[model samples]
Target: MSEFDQHFPLFSFPPSKVPRLLNPLVLAYIGDAIYDTYIRTYLVSLPHHKPNHLHHEATKYVSAKAQAHFLKLWLPHLSEEEQDMVRRGRNAKSATIPKNANVLDYRHSTAFECLIGYLYYKQQHKRLSQLLKMIIDYKENEH
Candidate 1:
């Protein structure tokens, strides 16, 4: 968290490590940052790519439509427990949508991120990596 984040607490975790009701929207918020970082990392690892090329590649995968598509691909693979988490995140009520995203698209993206966050919180690194690889694979195959 940076100074701006500290000053503006858009979402704050409850006092408990695990709240009675996990907020999927909050999970999505965190996942949004994580996802961007992951995409940038992937782009940076590629040799001989210009900054513009990397940005385009990252944008293609991170767009609302792409994230929603990935949600469909990954949702079936989650364990029962993770499915519950995803459900909570998906059904979470939220007041705002991203400026660039429509309501349906934004909600779907949030749901997908919530699933990723849930997996990460559970320390299911292998599972998360596998799911992410599927998403990346789709992006690669698109080219």
Candidate 2:
């Protein structure tokens, strides 16, 4: 019933080759959008929150620093394939950095986005939600 349902592949794979994934970039791409959606949704869910307030709050959580924090939390739970995905995304060449963020932070943020994108595109909605929840929980508990 979600957009993710429409976008991601919803098929079971053969038992033999189900280690991780062949296309890491795909994950990154989808993960980026998925992550943004969650952040925006989270902000919009707040009661009486104006657009500017929502944008500011979401920005804090979606920043490179915040994503880097998530990567640290996510690192321990990843398989070799997932790690490779992160690495590829983190190290990917980009034409620009985020508005006020540094180069290194931007790369890490992009990698995190890519990972979310990958999982969403793969139709691993459960897995995708699990990671996003961690980010939300961490942020919620931080304050």
Candidate 3:
């Protein structure tokens, strides 16, 4: 078990049970929260504690455009099965689109969130951490 599991001790269903049971959008729903929490924690660790600055900086990472950009960059690194999960999410028809995000970016962002949710529920903690680290590294390098 990794340090995260030791500290957090979240209960995860078996991988075999997850994709078969949950809708892609449902996965994206939880994934959004999970990613948001990770981003918030990361920002706070960097000492961006002021509320307004924290929220503004978070939008740099958590916005749909940003997520979609990261997803595109990471796609070539994903496994075939992982890619399929993204495909399912990208094709999912949501009831509404955010006024700020374009359709393509929103779909791709959903795909990214779906992958994160899948990895989380499947308890692929190490892999999830690796992917999350890649995002951090990529963003940091963009300076």
Candidate 4:
């Protein structure tokens, strides 16, 4: 078990019951929350602690454009099955898009979030951590 699994002990759905059965958008919903929490936790661990500063900093990583960028970087590295999940997410239509976000970026971001949610529900915590860590490392090196 990964260190994160040991510490957090997620009550994931049975592997046979979810992911395939759930809607891609539903997966994106949970994935969005999970990703946001991870980003918030990482920011809190840094020198900045003020709520406003943290929120601003978080937007850099959590925005649709940023997520789409990360997804593009990750595509070549993903397994075929993982890529399928991303495809499902990217193709899933939504009723609304944020005014500030490009449609393509928004779709890609949903794809990214869907992958995150799939991993989470499937209890692939180690892989999830690895993928999320890649984003953190990439962002840290960007400055």
Q: State every prediction's TM-score relative to the real structure.
A: 0.79, 0.78, 0.90, 0.91
Clashing residue pairs in candidate 4 (N, C-alpha, C atoms within 3 angstroms): none
TM-score, prediction 3? 0.90
Across residues 3-105, which tens digit of lDDT does each residue of candidate 3 receive? 4454334654444454537899988987898789888878888955899999999999999999999999889899997899899999999999999999999
Worst-scoring 10-residue span by lDDT in model 2:
13-22
**Model 2 alpha-carbon miss at residue 101, Å:** 1.4
Query: 2 or 4, which is superior by TM-score?
Result: 4
The Cα RMSD of model 3 versus the native structure comes to 2.4
Per-residue alpha-carbon lDDT of candidate 2 for residues 1-143, written as tens digits (9 for 90 to 100) = 54434334444542233325534455555567667777776677679588788888887778788888789889988878667778988888877676788888888887888777666555568777677777778888987
TM-score winner, 1 or 4: 4
Stretches > 4 Å off in candidate 2? 1-27
By the TM-score metric, which is better: model 1 or model 3? 3
Please provide, for model 4 over 62-122, each residue's C-alpha lDDT reduced to its tens digit, 9 standing for 90 to 100. 9999999999988988999899999999999999999999999999999999999998987
What is the per-residue lDDT of model 1 for residues 12-90, given as tens digits with 9 covering 90 to 100? 4432456325567767776787677777777787784898888887888798877888888887777787777767877
Residue 5 alpha-carbon offset, candidate 2, angstroms:
7.1
RMSD of 2: 5.2
Each candidate's number of clashing pairs is 0, 7, 0, 0
Q: How many backbone clashes does candidate 4 have?
A: 0
Which order, best to worst by TM-score?
4, 3, 1, 2
TM-score of 1: 0.79
Q: Which residue pairs in candidate 1 collide?
A: none
